[model samples]
Target: MLDQAWFSKVGFDWHPHRGFETVTLVVEGQLEHHDNAGGHGVLDPGDLQWVTAGSGVIHAELAYRRRPVQTLQLWVNLPRRKKMSQPRYQNLRAASAPLVEGPGSRVRIFAGDINGVHGPAELHHPVTVAHAHYEEGGSFTHEIPGDHNGFLYVVSGSVLVGPDRMPVENGHTAWFPPGEPGLTGIEVHATQATQLVFYSGLPIREPAFAYGPFVMNDRSGVAKAIEDYQSGKFGPIPTTHR
Candidate 1:
């Protein structure tokens, strides 16, 4: 996950990429996307875009206006079989994602299933991602998968996790290691008005070689990626992609 941790920030000029996936989750104001893959759009709060730069692609993200633009661009590694698949994209808007409310809290599911409900994202891997909002003193409990790697990130508030109600400060990513660990469902309490994002996924226990935007399984794969990129395997960014 990559972020400037600011609601409003500037971005670099357009760039090219390959060998991985980018999931941009907009949490604040607005963001604009332009890419060589014939993609362009403005993302408001709660909007997310998934870009699969399989074989190759070029893309850029920038501020859409003077609005706050806090967004998390997460790169999920691709396995060998999906490393060369055709690039694709899917945008899941805020309204379309499932919203579950409890007392003074609201939880929006972006991917994976919870309470037999699924979010509107399609991806090569199995994972669950969700954003949560809580009023002061609000509390919510969630049933996590038995064997999934799960954790919670405190976006901007104090929170307590697990039965012990471990205190988590802002800007902290509280990781929950796998196994019973005496934790089954997690109960989160907001010491103040708070917001958080939860994640759970099947662990991809493989070696990874990474450079810039490319993430491969080994050194040779990284070298080949560099070669393909220099040789223009990824197309150019169109002037009108924005």
Candidate 2:
């Protein structure tokens, strides 16, 4: 949730988590991150970092302000079976992410494929993540898969989905039904520009039990996780900050 407003100070501190995956996408400047699993890196503009805190892990994200830092942090719930798996990480730079551009529009593929051009992000779930930009009167059609759930977060400007035309300004999100697949038109006035993030993921058919940073399947599982953390099983939190 780090935005353009808070670039002077570090946004988040070292925190422990279990049974979920965190995806950080840097749209503006840089984000430096380090974790208890011996993972550390920076996510620059157009870069993305995926952290799978399967069993348990502690991590922190600090905003690097050589330039303005604007990014999105998404927490995806993991399946029950993979919740106890080992922790992992994947960092993708801007140059490695795939892109598609037309007359007045451009698309950055962050997770899934668009017209057979897939992003470098490796996901355990079926997901499509993309950022799109459009000029005045420009439009692009996103062919969403019928099986996945899809949503759009407006970073700036206005868009038309189906027969409804709505203004999608910064910090707003929109969700769409799975079966409806058509041209999601984004039209900006000549004096305005538009940007939006699109994401779709396969639905987990299992129950979700969320508490603080922990997202598990059952109440007892959550209790056991807290006990494990307090018992020094995942190692004590690092004293030194990265």
Which candidate wins on lDDT? 1
Please estimate how well model 1 matches the true structure, expressed as its whole-model Cα lDDT.
0.77
What TM-score would every model get versus the actual structure? 0.91, 0.87
What is the C-alpha lDDT profile of model 2 across 1-242, one tens digit per residue? Answer: 22333464676778888998888777777888888767778787778888888899888888764445777777888888889878888897767778887657788887876656688887777777887887876766676666667777777777665445655566676676665443333332212477877877777889999888888999988898899898978767888774
* Best candidate according to TM-score: 1
How many clashing pairs per prediction, in order?
A: 1, 0
lDDT of 1 by residue, 14-105 (tens): 77666778878887888888777566888888788888888887787877764567877777777777888898888889899999877788
Model 2 ranges off by over 4 Å = 1-7, 65-68, 180-191
Pairing residues by index, what is the TM-score of model 1? Answer: 0.91
- Backbone collision tally, model 1: 1
Candidate 1 deviant stretches above 4 angstroms: 2-9, 66-68, 180-184, 239-242
